[model samples]
Target: MVLSAKTKQSGVTSTTNMDKPNNSKRPLSHATDSTRTSESCDVLVLSNKMMTNLTSEFLTEQTTQPDVISKVLLERNKLKDLPFELVDFINLEVINLSYNCFHQFPSVICEMLSLREIIMVGCEIEALPSNFDQLSGLETIILDLNHLRKIGDTLCTLNKLTTLSLGMNYFSVFYSTLPDQITKLNLDNNHLAVFPDCILALANLRQLNLSFNRIKELPVEIDGLTELEELLIVKNRLHALPSTICNLV
Candidate 1:
């Protein structure tokens, strides 16, 4: 009942607007993507640089030394696709490409095996690549505000995933099974009329957000989520209550 609850992704990789990268900067060309922080630290912030496409050449040109970076923040860019040369980042882990104009998941990201987190909010992406399962090391995925409807079990393979944010999209139905290890689930502002049955199976779930939907009621079997801690249910069409909700305590 904190009213501040925000929904995360359901069965796919998603991000949130709140978790957006720092995109506060004057519009610059892709050539000047490097920032003062990247020159000194392992975290590279290439946000608000007006980049339509990120290239390995620019990565190399960012500094005289082109080696493994830990985190790369490329928020509020116009990136649609990444170069294949991106695979050279063997040790790269976290990448933030939020608030872009991509209509599809950048396939080059699939090869980064060491990656753990991928945050890309406010994009036009509709589908994930076929090789998305290759990233077994992924632990978090934030992909809010896009055209995602069905996940096709792409995220189910990410056994390491714990947090997924996919709110503010076109999800009227979600049949894909999410990872049982997932601790937080967000499905706000979608077209869901009936509560997703798949969610009831997550015994380890701690936080759940089903706000801003068309759901009318909850099932009495809701008590199955014994580990749930925070539940957000705002702006729904519910007229009745499920007695099992009391068991969440």
Candidate 2:
């Protein structure tokens, strides 16, 4: 359930199985050229190593060449800062750095012009970069279980984004204007007290989750979601059903 990727580099798009048995405990710097076999493909799988300890020579030796690696899986490695050499992978399309120690959204990610998806769940991220909208090719972003207290307005500028998950964060209000193409939105387990009026703008939304919040009433505007097929608002403090909800059918 971590991040995965498909790369046009190496003319190969493969998924790295994090479940693979780690038979090599050798330091990444000592990994022989033989380890870069077809079995590893384009994935540089590290087993529970602290990324901060990796030397630039070790990284360069592992990748051999920047264009040879199109996908990088650094999840669960307790990464605090992105490797400075990662920008060399000019064709990178996906990045999954979940379950790490990141406290702020890495600004270095914006430099990957080819990135299509970013998964960073269970981090301490408090805010995204101001120019995050420059990632025009990004299509999916998952930032669940972070420390975010509010959605950024720049999020609406990613015209290609279709899925966004912000569940289990510290959000008290929903004020950002999401792109119209977003089909799935997760805002579960936040501190919201009232329904966000911005939800009405997602005309193409098909699924929405607002569970485990402090909302007290359903807005009559809920009927504006004509394309919605699944709505989850359980665990709120609703006293009565809004009659306008009948218009959903």
- Candidate 1 segments whose C-alpha is farther than 4 A from its true place: 1-40, 64-66
Lowest summed lDDT across 10 adjacent residues in model 2 is found at: 21-30
**Clashing residue pairs, backbone N/CA/C < 3 A, model 1:** 8-166, 8-186, 9-165, 9-166, 14-142, 14-143, 15-142, 15-143, 15-144
- RMSD (CA, Å), candidate 2 to true, equals 13.0
Q: Mind giving the per-residue lDDT tens digits that candidate 2 earns over 147-238?
A: 99876688888999987888888989989888999987888788999988888899998767776788877789878888975566666666
- Per-residue lDDT of 214-238 in model 1, one digit per residue for the tens? 8877789988988876666656677
CA RMSD for every model? 8.4, 13.0
Model 2: residues with Cα > 4 Å off, grouped in runs: 1-40
169: Cα error in model 2, Å: 0.6
Q: Tell me the lDDT of model 1 at 177.
A: 82
lDDT of each: 0.72, 0.71
